[model samples]
Target chain A: MAPKKLGLKQRYAHMTRGLDWETTYQPMDAVFPYDTFEGIKIKDWSAWEDPFRLTMDSYWKFQAEKERKLYAVLDAFAQNNGQTGVSDGRYINVVKLFLTGVSPLEYQAHRGFAFTGRHLRGAGPRIACQMQSLDELRHLQTQIHTISHYNKFFDGIGEFPHMHDRVWYLSVPKSFFDDARAAGPFEFMIAIGFAFEYLLTNLLFVPFMSGAAYNGDMSTVTFGFSAQSDESRHMTLGIEVIKFLLEQHPDNLPIVQKWVDKWFWRGFRVLGLVAMMMDYMLPKKVMSWKEAWEIYFTEAGGSLFQDLERYGLKVPKYADVATEAAEHISHQNWAVFYQYSHAAAFHTWMPDKEHLDWLSEKYPNTFDKYYRPRWEMWAEMEKEGKRFYNPSLPQLCQVCQIPMAYTEPGDPTKIAFRCTEVAGETYHFCSDGCKDIFDAEPEKYIQSWLPVHQIFQGNCGGATVPDVLNWYRMNVGADNMDYVGSPDDRLWSEWHAAKTREAV
Target chain B: MSVTAIVPDYARRIEPRDPVENFHGNMLVYVHWEDHLSFCSAVAFPLPPAIPFGAFVSEVVAPAYAAHPEAASIDWSAVVWMIDGATKVPDMEASLAANGMKHKTLVRFWTPGLSGWKGTAS
Candidate 1:
């Protein structure tokens, strides 16, 4: 009898291709140098194999289909007057937070992917990189298109480009990439592909999707899911690249190991913002940061590190640090966000009863002991008709540009501060190395377009919240408020009355 | 091409002075791989030397290639990993051999700021 073949391969083959394929929407260009630079010798570019095989035709077809599905849901929600029906208007602040902080990141991904497609030597790797490049661009575009709908009803969505440039908070992302751009090619792979995509992406993207689902922001959920499906392929490529390098040469191990160590910490440090967003900012919270980090990083990448241990590579130097930080960052970072809400893109009211209860239940060790009292104190101020704002400017970390939320390694409460003198002026930072970076090249960091300084200097729209909100494209309680019986309230009442009559 | 015939880009008028390349890209190297955690770390700290060139590729240059997927299939030769600073490993040649690695040549260069780890040849 002839050998019987299983249906799995045939089934996958049938389902994987044809009209379902989504490829690049943009054209290609020779952006990086191949023969021009003289340092590296290339014998065979084909050795660079991309584990994720993506083509242009398939890329467009699938991507367009996904977008069509998204817009359909968005349109349905809009046509049904979903804005008025939203259970809580305050939840929109989370989306607003996402728009300013996470939205621009899509564009940054687009830029990086495009670079990979052009400069990488191997056809397979290049094509894979190219496809991801397009995927990120689509992500950026779709995110903008989807979020713009909310702009019609909210505020602060318009300030993203300016916020990205001028906001001190934005430096967390800008400087991270700046460091990578200054390195070599192999480092790029380890930093981005291995350290970031393979290890940390699940922790980042999953919370975003869950947050969207919890908050009923269908557009964000849809886009995040669609984008993450592609991330699995990117993650595969990352694993392949690291494995290939480690297996290829012994010297490569130490070099690659060092990169793994550096980038793991670099990537972990950036997650502080995400930790804050997930645990505090999202009104309808899902899992805590500690839970997500342990599953994604400690389990998946940690196992991979065990595999690499035979090849003489240490688990990322910061693995334990990241785990410990993840355990407690939620309360620390959110406290910072709560105090600074007036200056941020989103609004920060006290965590409602349910949210407070959730925190108390989820974080028993530190919530009641430390953070809850702080919010209660703020609530007292609110009762007195006063809002709490940190009047003193936060001393920015020279490297991360964050208001030094990171504490002494194990102790989460003690603030870490480092200082350096440059050009006869003493500058302060949160870490020793950051101060060194500033001191070594004062010219670079001196020109950082800090947001708080910009706002105080009147470079932003105006001095007042209402003025700035308008400039930020926010259409909230100010322009679209309903204190008693305003237009939105009257319209909402009529809609509800008709619904009640229909029910009768 | 003769050594003198090649007017090197970095060190003006160098003739075969042990060529070493760093794959650190420009413009969009650190842009992709957009996990906020990674992005923050890149900004806030001195990145470990694991993939010294990751920032170059991830943020500076990867995006251009991302813009053009159709042209991904191309070929090249020879892989060289450059370590500009210091290492605990003694005997660079033996280390290279043990690691199953080979380079056209190994050039040791001194870079300040990498204090404790600076290479012995410097």
Candidate 2:
């Protein structure tokens, strides 16, 4: 007779719990050294629950099927000359930014999860992290493969790995993951799994995917959908870890709460890049960044915190500040990028009439009153063959590494600045949130590799524009600055002109 | 305390202290109180020479805090000026220029014993 097959739940239990054994030669603490250092009290490892009930066999099967489907779409996208199908060449900058900034983060997440998976004391979270590790790695690979098609037709796509490490703007995402990676296992989980993946991932991923769909980049949309299916599982793991730690001991609540506050603001600051991309970069806009923030964060996230209320957890410390910032952050960041696009790897442009009208509609309270006039000034300059680019580098905040561009909370008219003097030397922060993070761990942040500081110190390429661009491995005229007279722009116009001739 | 008198002198003192040698110009010197959590905002102004630290606090930081909704309760006289790490600049009569402060130099106004504020420094 054939061996009896296990049922689904039994199979999950056998695959997950059965993998663990009592270690006689080495104690559990010696074996798993990372889990307890974060001060999280876990009384029983068995109390951990993998909500997906996922096993290695099922995990591999599902991911493999998803990969096959994603690759098929990517192939068709390439075969059909999908680059030409995009709404406009300007849209490619969104892909370029995604490739250079966000994809490398996926690889970093993979490494972070793999380390945590191996070291976490609980078999439940370990398996979940391990599976999520593979998922992150898959996301990185699929994104690179999908966007590499654009690299052939685009300028800024080359040297992404190097750029992610060294570029000024890319530092936002790089430093964020590095901060999480340096934390204790539990803190790392809370930072990425909960604060980033569960609470804020939709705001980052959904808009980009929908923007991809709107811009006719089907490959990105396909890969995005494929990765999002796994994101649901990652989200479950995020909430589970938070609940597990909270249930373990009452002392764990405050620690978890602080991490929630710190990581939420950190993640929100990083998404300022995404917010600008959604509101400005897409030729055909999907949804306003403010609208997405209200739906995904204010509404959905508010409910999530409400669910956790019984566990004695409150919303993050600066939730209201972030809610208010959503209305203004995209406008503020895009303006900074517009002025300093010369130093960046990606292109920036003034939004056309239709785009400006949409922004005015979406941000009626502040757009016309505060932001529209600046764009109008730039647009006026462009009309006379003059584009304004700030020749000097702006001051960078110590913690977030962004240019000091944010305004005071509840007051968009004044630039908000926060500073703390520690041990004699003063550090500047973009907001109270960043200032608080630095004050808590000054030693960690004082070592930030700020690009502007690095350049001034003669660490980046050299002192001049040519030297720095070469050092950043950027193509200068081809890869960066205003999109109006760019090679991509010229190519776009010529392609359309040829199409018009063909139709005649 | 004339605005024009302070402007040119502050520019002269602060412009040369930029850590980046290539960066030369008037830059903002940001000061904040360490003990008062409500006093987190950096009161930025051009650096001026020969201004007493006490006057700087009373005139600059105090008014800024007074404007803030939550910071009205902070005691201005009790705060100490901290600069360059652990060094305490005890002479409030000394000018910022005499004490060697520069543009973007962070001066933290700290109180010795403030209850309810979480102190991270050991």
Candidate 3:
């Protein structure tokens, strides 16, 4: 006969705390050598609380059910030829950026969580991280499986893992993860769990998922929903980690605050790529990046910092600068990509007149004044049969690795530049925030694998454009440069034409 | 020969001739240092062309220990300069124009012990 069924709280407590123990043979520090080195003083390990109170049994069962639903949708999407269902061929580039840039980051998250799970001193956070680790791995797998459907029909999606590792632009996300992973365990939690998942995730995830929904990419939407459902729990974990640290000891506040500042800016700079994707790449625009930032960061994040203010915690430094930048970064980044698309692993095209009008409406203050004129010049160039590309590579920031194209704060005329002198050498940053991060840890950033510098150093493929593209595993005409007269464009036209004929 | 004699034609074209107006007012130069294992950092300074390149290297770049702590241990007198990826600016009293330097030009500083210089494509 089976034993009496246990209640939810009892089961969760038993499942999570059952394995933890008081050390008899060895000291706790001896057993967990990795956690305390970062100087985060934990007064009581049992005081650590898991907000979800998730048991492994319930976790596996719930996750399995979600997987079943997601797999059913994935199978249906592939079986029904879902690639054709997207709004336009340009919509696929969004998926390309997601697959190449964002998906691998999930895998990195998986590894990072697993590392923290094993090393953290407390059983509470360890179990939470382990669950999130599995969740990240699942997200990575589902994202790949979903986008692999497009790989069979597209060019750029084929070699994403390789491209993520070696390509120039992909380094932004890669280096962000690498920086987090290289930090100490507590710093890792603050970096990934708190700063990334809690503070800035909505800005990253909501736009893509909503864009997927609007563009009729049902498979992506399903996967996004699945991952995002887990993200809620991760968000709780992020909040819990911050609160746990701040409440533990007074010393933890300053340390946690620094991580918040550094990771917030790092996360913000990385989201510049996403901002550009949201504004420019989507065939059917959801909301402007400015709208998303104002809603997610300004409103929600404002309330969050207010809540934390009682604990002597404050909002991230440079947050106002980031708010000011929301108007221009998307446009600036997209313009850069439009001019340099030949060097990238995805296609770019001039925003049509309607899209430009939408942009002007969305960004009334800055779009028409600064960015519109540049796009109009490019349009005239295209009309004159001279599609322009920047022959020379722009100088990249040593810390963030983005090209030094960011304009001065409040004034978009001059480039914003910040530099610091360390040990008789100079390091340049895109902004004061990035420069501050570099200054705080000169040794860490001094080892950055800047792609432009690597290319100049003869480390990337070879010396020429063809060689670099080959090294990046990109097909020249099919994958790189303008999408106007390419194979994807031709196929899209043919498919639409056939649809019209069939309707007739 | 001084760095001016060996300055590349492309760099020379961009170098400012008017020292007082250009360098003192608005001209900026970006300097970078790299070692064999990819140790690097770039610093930007609004420098006057009237100041000698050697003085800039010694007074400005050498004392910039805060940006690059690794450089503090190294001897600044031993470092060499690569201007705009081509001309090797020697340790002498050459003006910004004399070294073919202009606003926003990148100057790379390295030591003899570092790895061989990999030429940058124009």
Candidate 4:
């Protein structure tokens, strides 16, 4: 027999160490040019510690096992016709949003991490990013495979990838990922890895996974479980990168703080979609958006920042604004969806009496006062055969790309609108947080592709609504309208009726 | 606080994505019906700067807000109109350009008695 196999720690060291070598053909400065431009100082590359220890040898072996488990569940789901098990047809809209809006972001993360892994000089962090890049690719593939079963039985799942690129509301998440990917390597890590993956991923993932479990969707819940282990590794890498940068040099503290502030605000702005799903889309609710925000961001993030206080890193700016917004954003976002239902890929409808009362109970202070009456009025209009869809396109915020629907922080009754003249032209933002972000980097955000502006400029399609609808590839009257009379609704009703008769 | 360049010696002077001239003889203007959160946000319109303000209000803006229950009760002439937050009474017959409404101008109009449905700001 050969020599005894090496211990786990020894094997990890042997595989990771001695991997980075000096460039003989080119200078070290030219090879690792991206790391220094962000003003971060790293005295020693070896000081970078691995948050999780797995070389490519083990990485492939470990991931293949996860793939096997994920696919087995997916096959089982399809064999049993798992689409019929959901709580309601409305719940399919939630999955439709995720497939179109979020899965493409995973693709973006894959590309970002590949760029990051290649550019970073340190072998330790390089290997870390490489593993994460692969994880992201796997996440995107598994998500598509998991949601594809629903595609066979749903109205809105056919055009997910196309919709992600062209849809107006989707620009919110697209722009966010695009901004991060275009930044320097260190900033991408902080923006996506630290701020998004670590800071805010829970708020996004919890509703989808737990909502899937609560609503009896076996395929999606299995996908969530498959991705859970990789997610922990990503969160660990996020913390390690922050600690590595802060510990590397004293000059890095302020730069890291600025990035933390910017991405935290950006992440909060994009989570409004998830907030709406949690509050309105789920037929069987996991929790209210406010409760999820309290648990994920307020309570958990508080102690996290407190831990970082010794490193001279305070909480992100606009934390107070975000806290106040957790209560109102879901309601505001649902109103936007309700009024613009004609333009969306998925169907939209006003909540029923049971749902409205649940929202009122969950959001006692502001729901009845600010939101319930609007729902009641819209519901009444629906009953009277006069469904209200906003005829005009909405004014979008330049930075966030969401419509300017958010109200003032202090006064909920008045809409908050902020604008500034950048280079003698005006740019509008929904809040001071976004305005400040733009003020810092107007050169970057000023080039934002606001979809409404594009549609107005004749870049989308032709002059008519049908022209734009054709460009979006949305099957109007079936894919983009009230759910009550749509094809999906009728099919779901027929299936349940047949099942009821069989039971009798 | 500017964005740090990814590569050294990169150009910094950037152009706005959607500028004034891109709209093809039309200008982008936002109309906010101040207290009506039911419309959800200020509605954006691509209007010719030469369009008369009076006709723009009734032809374009009124149709947008016509579905609201209070739309019928509002006195259009008595509404308080503010252009870009500076209160100004516009000449309804005058063109948008003559009324000082330029690109990205936010025209917020407040109905004297109707804040929102039942004053709930709905």
Better of 1 and 3 by TM-score: 3
Predicted candidate 1 versus true structure: per-residue lDDT over A1-504, tens digit per residue: 998874754443343332232235642223344322323344444465547654465667887887888788778877876665543556566666667776676666667666765665555566776777777778778778777887776666766776665555666776676665444555566777777788888877788778778777777777776677678888987887777776666766766776677677767767777787777767667787877787888888778878878878888765776776676677666666665554565655577678888888877776675556556655665668655554333445655567655555665434454655443333446554355445544544555444443444456587565565455554555323221233334554676788799999
Model 3 lDDT per residue over A1-504, tens place: 998998888878888888788787998778888787677899987888886688888899999999999999999998988888799998998999999999999999999999999898789999999999999999999999889999887779989999999998899999999999988888999999999999999999999999999999999999998887799999999999999999999999988999899999999999998899899999899999999999999999999999999889999999999999999899878877876788887889999999999999999998886677667766876788767665445567877888777767997654566776554445567899898888776656767787765665567788687888899988888998888887888888888898899999
TM-score of chain B of 1: 0.18
lDDT of 1 at A418: 60
DockQ for candidate 3: 0.03
Q: Comparing chain B with the reference, what is the TM-score for each candidate?
A: 0.18, 0.57, 0.60, 0.91
Over the true interface, candidate 3 deviates by an RMSD, in Å, of: 18.7
Each prediction's DockQ against the real complex:
0.01, 0.04, 0.03, 0.79
Among these predictions, the greatest DockQ belongs to 4
Q: State candidate 1's TM-score.
A: 0.67
True contacts kept of each: 0.00, 0.02, 0.00, 0.82
**Winning candidate number (lDDT):** 4
TM-score of candidate 4 relative to the true fold: 0.98
Q: Write the per-residue lDDT of candidate 3 for residues B1-122, one digit (tens) a residue.
A: 11111123523334322222423354557665553111112444656766887788778766653222244456666777777657574646778768787655677766655332231100
Q: What residue runs in model 1 are displaced by over 4 Å at the alpha carbon?
A: A1-44, A84-87, A182-185, A419-427, A431-504, B1-122
Q: Candidate 2 DockQ score?
A: 0.04
Question: Relative to the true interface, what fraction of contacts does candidate 2 keep?
Answer: 0.02
Best by TM-score: 4
Per-candidate Cα lDDT values, in order, are: 0.56, 0.80, 0.81, 0.91
